[model samples]
Target chain A: MQIPKPYLLFLGDVRDALAVKMARGILTWRPEACVGQLRLDDQTPSLGIDDLPLEAGRERGAQTLVVGTANAGGKLPEHWVDTLEQAIELGYNVASGMHQRLAAIPRLADAAKRQGVKLFDIRHDAPALEVGNGKRRSGRRVLSVGLDCAVGKMFSALALEAELKSRGEKADFRATGQSGILIQGEGIAVDAVVADFISGAAEYISPANDADHWDLVEGQGSLFHPSYAGVSLGLLHGAQPDFLVMCHELGRPHVRHLPHIQLPSYAACVERNLANARTTNPDVVLAGFSINTSNVDEAQARAHLAEIEAEFGVPATDPVRFGVGPLIDHLIERTR
Target chain B: MQIPKPYLLFLGDVRDALAVKMARGILTWRPEACVGQLRLDDQTPSLGIDDLPLEAGRERGAQTLVVGTANAGGKLPEHWVDTLEQAIELGYNVASGMHQRLAAIPRLADAAKRQGVKLFDIRHDAPALEVGNGKRRSGRRVLSVGLDCAVGKMFSALALEAELKSRGEKADFRATGQSGILIQGEGIAVDAVVADFISGAAEYISPANDADHWDLVEGQGSLFHPSYAGVSLGLLHGAQPDFLVMCHELGRPHVRHLPHIQLPSYAACVERNLANARTTNPDVVLAGFSINTSNVDEAQARAHLAEIEAEFGVPATDPVRFGVGPLIDHLIERTR
Candidate 1:
């Protein structure tokens, strides 16, 4: 898939919890491709790509403004229409992670049409797929299994894929959700897929062309996550991964959205994921861990990583903070 | 919902599997609502409402000819369009159970429109639902938990609901499939729903209004069926039923569509279903069994029912042949 350089736009108050999903995804996964973030919420200090203004981003030749949030219901907030209108009118393409298509909205669509820019609604228009038959896939597969939903499964997979590409290895990152769809031009939002077709979508994305190549399938949800366990199972069954890279947020006590439910220990999470994976593919194995150290400092993150490594007897690293080098290297030496 | 009497039209060969699904469902659940079957296949003798010809059904004041077969993929077959056109020309409303809406087909739609008769696409407009939280339901619920797919879970639920109504009890049969949708006036095709929303759709359909009333919720695939276990889990979690009526097809040794996978024992099926159900509702109980004895003779069917009842210590009956009286009585006595 051809990658597009995009200006990141967080139209809402940047400090708000809903605003950061797409922004963080782009900032973490494809930082180099991101020209800059438009600081709609002026109160907060601009970090990373937010240092450059929209005008500067335009001058730097950013083609699209990747709307920076996979908000609840995927609905564009009414207040942000003006910012979207401005972005479209300025000859910039608009890419949205919302379930509601950006092209469906009148003002933004009209502006984009007049300005000759494309509106990419990443979540919509996913082709309907049939039920997956667990046939033996013909490629080296490494799935980034998560400790919880939004714990950097996509980031870990993409980082590993990037590393593989840098090393002149044939690799592909299969996106599973909206953020991943935005980053990688192709993917089915597995959670959005109907119950009967989850595994099918997974199978569709994680196809094996050559035994020597790798398909780093980005996982969604977690086996321990009560609400999302089905999606987790479907993806796991679909991928039928030979090796698993456990992705986890450093200090997440419980599953997000379900605060009452406590997060399982690293060992328990890995065991559950592996057990589920082994149901469809008996020879499945956990390669390593991709720890999300975004919430912790360098020393704290490193100490926690070491602690998990000692506890689970597996190599762990933050793909962003450090890199998924240990996990990638392990996968190469083992599977490839 | 108002029941409409229509001439049952199965344009295909009578022995065709799809022909019998709607015919059997209607005959078993709402026989009074069925006028007669139009025997397109000449060799086979028509039973029940099939004895009356289309002219006879029309003379008897049948307003609509319910297209009694729910064919897979919901597409109206090319040959069947002629019969549908004839039905429309004869000043009759058309009801189809197919996933492909009857209104979408140009010829049939135009014919119905021009004839000033309504075309009911039963499975077309199921509302989108949220994720099921498995909250404690208020009213009595008796879900027909099947041993496998196409084992007459819907049939048993409808039969029990009819029995309850005959006994002057306020009970509703909630349909989960296309055949059930045609048999009843409404239902969501739960299988078509996204994995995350299956439970939610179940919760939506099985509403708790009065404590005295009962919801005879139709089950989908089996917990033991490998391909459909996720849906089974979601439905079980969604219903949070007070009681379960196990549905099984006698003489079936393996799961449908998956021939290599052997069917689990009765005890294992019940245990797994109850365990999954109890995750959402702790006090849930197995009320009875709805055994589909369609493959066997009367004596053999009776013997098998008796054997299952004696073995499992639960009432067992074929809803179509023996009626669901024993199971209905058991549920009424226990839950009420």
Candidate 2:
């Protein structure tokens, strides 16, 4: 398979004209852009790009696109590859949806390039990175949280409390479901957030760090959600936190599916995270190093500091195991 | 610190008498059960224990319970382990709020064994392995999927399509999301599908056989959600699948945040899976895998798989890289 240099693509039920229109905007901007997230009935819904103006592309030659509709016609289309390719050649700038995964884009592109087939995969139109400006938070501090109501939320908030107190400053710890952490400019409407950002509200703070205290937030699920959309990234961009301390579950076999999809998976998460980071640009990303008990013979928590340090690029100490001091120390060092 | 055998517990909103009653039932049945899901706020909002009368056992020589309460007065009246050693002394029985991970449960247990702590922590609970079958799926042979939408709902449907065809049977593929996948005989809820059977729906006709034959069943979202309040585990014990196929995001690292509240850290995925497995008792477990392509790397994916395999002993593969055929073959071989 010819690997295509990766580009972002957003996946949705393109049969929805609004979704298709949104995708069209991306395609128009980049001749090779691909639209995705089409399910089986997409074609029946009258969203076919058969008549879309692809002629604008001999200039760019229909950016190698992959046209996937969420479903295979009663059977994998006999000329599925050919018909789709021809459509794009004839100026249909949409590829069939391949779920939300753009991981195969690079590979598909490489193959298409070798075969001299212009490929347009949906990975090319993923939402751009998130960056926002709002009430900022920052500091070097230790936080020990009680995992009660909202697990990640409490941890983030409590950690923020400790960090802010250590710095002898205060900043609001807001969990905006996507619109954003907080906006410094005039209040923007949800419509604008989605229309303008093509995502949720921004979760950001002022990059300048004007706030006297650091706000550490956790658990309130954000970032990965599409509706909350670009808001999380936007907020982070604005905050430019010294270190992004994210606490979520990494799938571990031994953990008994402990961290199921209550949230983001590793790939989309990283993609969105990096996308957000490219805009927000935090100094570091520290995943709260937690594991499910049954998943693996967890590295002996006591003897596992070196591994933690090596893997995370920072010292590792369990607060529950080691007194809260060393754990906090490492957390601070990580942000710096 | 005393380490103990951990059991997986799913305690949904303890404030709901139903939830508390489930906890009480677990205590009575398991007796050695510890570590429940912190369903509600331990403070004013929740009764904390749902009138189950936790105090009845206080006479068991100050029964050691390492309880982590949100409103848990930092200074407890008695019988709770805020300190690690105190937890060790509470051998055989312990309770704590949700999302509190044991960074060193096994190791501590081992150490305590040496120090004579004789501890017991139901942090990692396994379903009863024996599969008891009294009923079979009647109706349309709808496969109820319990996999999270996180991996995109393609797994069960995709696998269903592949498995049916491989067995030389033309199966109708229907991924019912908003609407529930229908079936008859023993009513298989999400709980049974996850903990008991290999596949949620009893039998699936491959969708690939005929596109016109497809019926994409929408998920009711919350309806499939296991009601931990009811002693649902017993219900699942009725239907045992031949082989259980579980989908996982192999290298999807972004989900690591949910574990903060001792809520299973995405590992809850597995616990929930097994919760259903306990009832269904599917023999072989086939795990379909994928990753978040946005931010993670191949190394993380490899590690995630290796780690999960080591822990669950289930066969997992990424459908994107390795087609579903090989995974099916592996499952067939394991079952044979």
Candidate 3:
């Protein structure tokens, strides 16, 4: 299904990392699906988007107004409700990727319902999942694992799936989180599953199929992320991938939010991911790397990519900028 | 709270491994609490318990008839309901640790309600758990790691806690599965928790408090089981244990049910558990081993225990038979 071009709204300061993360994910991966951005604070010189006032974006044919900033608690700020209400009143779908449910908020939900518009509270509506049976099927499985959560794992998996499909390859994008679920129209929200069955849910979606097919299973959480390591491990084991793509942002020094704790080296991170994956599937192989260069300049991004490729001996690319052509080629040849 | 003395029912072949397992666990850990066993078959010559007919156990003052055999799919067999109905009609509490809820069965539930007795569907009524924050609590954590599921991880943890308590030491039993939850009266059934929050549930129940106190956290699943590796890893991380106790049945050559999957040596299993545990808590150590010698003769059990102790250079004991005094003493002295 072709989702309408969204009017991405970042009400918080544009330079704030958490505030701009979701917006960056959209702009980088699905920029064509976005009409423009509406921000209250305008200090986002590096956002690299058509910045519009909310009314102007609607006038420009934005069908959905997406609240694109995430707070620490993922709650929708009270002040943003007026802007969301305005969008709903004008017959626009309201979408949010926060933990707080827009449908749970009486005012916003009521407004959307009254105006006959859809309310997309991405996290809250994820489907319940069953326990995994660990049955391996025919097709090759490729999973995007990241150094930390929200470091372009989903973007990379989706981008790689799109790249593969463009070349007439039979590939499926299996989402493990809400955003991927919204995009794919079908996928178990792995994180929403009861902890006992998270891996099972992952296994359920990406089942054993023919070798000609490829399942680009979206990754959730992270092996190193303090808050979500269990989900990361569950996804790793459940996916039981033949190929693993290491997704990384250019220069994240520490896990986001936990400032004092530093992230392990890139090599160490990849090694750790592979080792954990081996606990269940000893044959899991690292295919390549998908680097997120959203915050880096072109030259710097290229240099870092080259450095990572040389160090890890894997094809590395910024899926949004450089495209995942080399990585896709490598996967096709290796799996075949 | 003192639980009602249960009439353990092994309606399936009494010689079946799973049928005798629950009976063995209850008899070993809390023998005084069991009135007697009610088996449909009489071929269990090795089951060291007073075998009673269903009516006889109830007549001997049994308050509950516990359906003790766990089937492959955890579904209640159709044939057993008739006997259960008879027990319910006689006003005995019904308890089951199966995935199929005894309270959900129409006839049995109605009969139990009418008869004014409780139906304890142990796994179904496990408390809902919150996501784990992975916060290390004050007390030193001691977790039971197993070579396979049903290898007495829960029994060993409970036994150790009892031994410590009898010695006037402060120790808490933290249950992570249905059987333990049924006995403890209060515990988060970790396996029932949403996948993303399994570890968090472990953390929520075993908070950091006094350094001198100990939380003997019962483990679930197995690190080597293909279908349950995720849960095992989550528990390892969630427990964030300072100490680990390896639990293994004496004669199992491979993972139960899945043949050809050879069980790893005690050292290899302990090392693997420690390596996974070190992902979060770097200082986790294996304190000792809890060998399940129920299937072995007394001479064979003692010989195996001596061999393991010599090979690993650690204290080893069958917590049920010889008690966990040696392991507890070692843990107390080492931690002190």
Candidate 4:
């Protein structure tokens, strides 16, 4: 799904910063694409971007009003319908990452229809996709696989894409989740797709490109994560990556939300991912490690990275704390 | 997803026997649940069952009219709508394994509603399920793992369940696909569920039961299949089988649809399935090998089974030809 931009991010009375993390991510990565922020009330968290009303944002060339903040139960609040309807009437396409679809609300749907605008439900709908054919596509892909959920896979991919662009190399960050879609302005939320089409959607996300071009495919749940490993495996096969960057959090005690399920060792995680990946791309190689070191001191993080690099004989770094330069360097060198 | 019992199989002018393989499966496995067969034309293949009109079938205690034949594109043939509506008017619940939903047809929907009957589109609908918690539950599960799609995973599971029942052991065949669902009269088609709920559906299919009871969970897809490994992996984690039976079709050269992609070795398939399965059930073990030997002579089939048993040190048999007795023997011994 291609979300229209420059976006006016809608933060509907959400007090928690985490609820508007998608807004923050879009502002941080693609600030130029965001025209302004729209809030329901003064209590809402500010994304540090300029605040603009619906008409003003539209006048400023905002093409879409993005519902960027998540609420309790991921539903669109009934009270916020008027603003969404007003935005639709103003000739702006409405987009949402909520569990509820904007089109499902009659007011917003009718308004968008009358105004000849669109409602992009990135989390709930995807373009029709065929099952993955396993044909070798002509592009170099680097995927970030993790030891568990929420372990910097998206961050690592975005960093790698930015680094590749900075070096004047051809690369694009392919998003496979809601927040990533907002940041990239286009993607399929593979997790929200029908189970039969996960891999097919992944294939659509990153299609055949020039042989030298790189598609940094963001991964999802880990192979060992019982709740979502299916999505992860399907994405892995569909990507058919030429290189893999293992993502992990240094101090994660267990798989997310399942305390009884312990995280696998880094070695085990890497080995298992590679083994499954080989079925689609036999030449796939581990390029580097992207460790989330936010919980550790700089010195300790550096020491851990050094130990990992020494043991695995690949570059390792925290993409957020340091940068993805070393990982990109390894990727470029190996691809060359 | 409990389909009402004593069905009248509907053969909608389908000339090919393969198109009605689901009907054949139900007849073979659960003959008691099938009252009669309904054919639109005399040219349609006979299922060796009593042929009856809709009214007569209903009088014979048929609770449901099962559209058991598949068409070219899996759509509900437009010409067959009148008969389906008539079936509904006769107060018979309708069930179909077609890509098109029975409820989506307005005539059938209205008729069913008016007559107080139900429309069951088994292939397109699933009950809501929570994400898999990866917790240990009561009762043992034995899942069939395969090297590729259509390697008889469902048949092996059904045979095992039947064999266990014959010995006066507590067992139930838990279906995961369309044909299996028809035979068992209840199941969630895991592949058709939303991607996030694949494992959840599997967990729902086989719930907690007596400690001595066995839920023979039918499997789908293959770990090495590019199009379907995600479903396989998710089902594996959700089923969390205490014992897995490796299903392989002897002499098969490649994956079912993708000829370029070769099937993995028996050792690789077993190892990968066991490794992934261990994340959910740490104590999971390989019970035996359920090899399909239809392509070979009896002597060759037995010889191949003997060779496999020697190599893997597990019982191996053609569940169709030699029966699942050896595999059940191994499972019983291991569990005891």
Q: Top model by DockQ, which number?
A: 4
Answer with 2 or 3, whichever has the higher lDDT: 3
**Candidates in order: C-alpha RMSD to true structure:** 5.0, 28.3, 6.6, 0.9
Candidate 4 C-alpha lDDT tens digits along A1-336: 688889999998889999998888888888999989998889898998889999999899999998888777988777788888888888999888888888888888888889999999989868988998788899899999999999989989999999999999999999999999989989899998888888888899899999999999999999999999999999999999998999999898889999999999989999999999998899998999999998989999999999999999999999989999998888888877
TM-score (all chains, Cα) for each model: 0.79, 0.25, 0.74, 0.99
Model 3 regions more than 4 Å off: A1-130, A259-262, A294-303, B1-28, B31-121, B124-129, B260-265, B293-307, B320-322
DockQ of 3: 0.33
Q: The CA-based lDDT of model 1 is what?
A: 0.76
Compose the digit string of candidate 2's lDDT tens values, residues A29-85. 233333222233435343333332223333334333333234422122434444444
Candidate with the greatest lDDT versus the true structure: 4
DockQ scores for all predicted structures: 0.35, 0.01, 0.33, 0.89
Q: Which digits, one per residue and each the tens of the lDDT, describe model 4 over residues B1-336?
A: 789999999998989889888899999999999998999999899999999999999999999999988788888877788899989898899999998888989889999889999898999878879998889889999999999999999999999999999999999999999999988889999999989888899889889999999999999999999999999999999999999999989888889889989899999999999999999999999999999999999999989999999999999999889999999989999889
Q: What is the lDDT of residue B98 in candidate 3?
A: 83
Q: B1-336, model 2: which lDDT tens digit per residue? A: 222323323232223444344234334323443433333234323323332223322333333433323232223222222334434443434433222333245554554575554442222221223222223333222222233334533344444555656687544444221111111001122222222221222222111223222222212111012112111122222223334344534343332232211112334444444443433333413343333322456676557666666766654555555445654565445534
Which is superior by DockQ, 2 or 4?
4
Candidate 1 DockQ category? acceptable
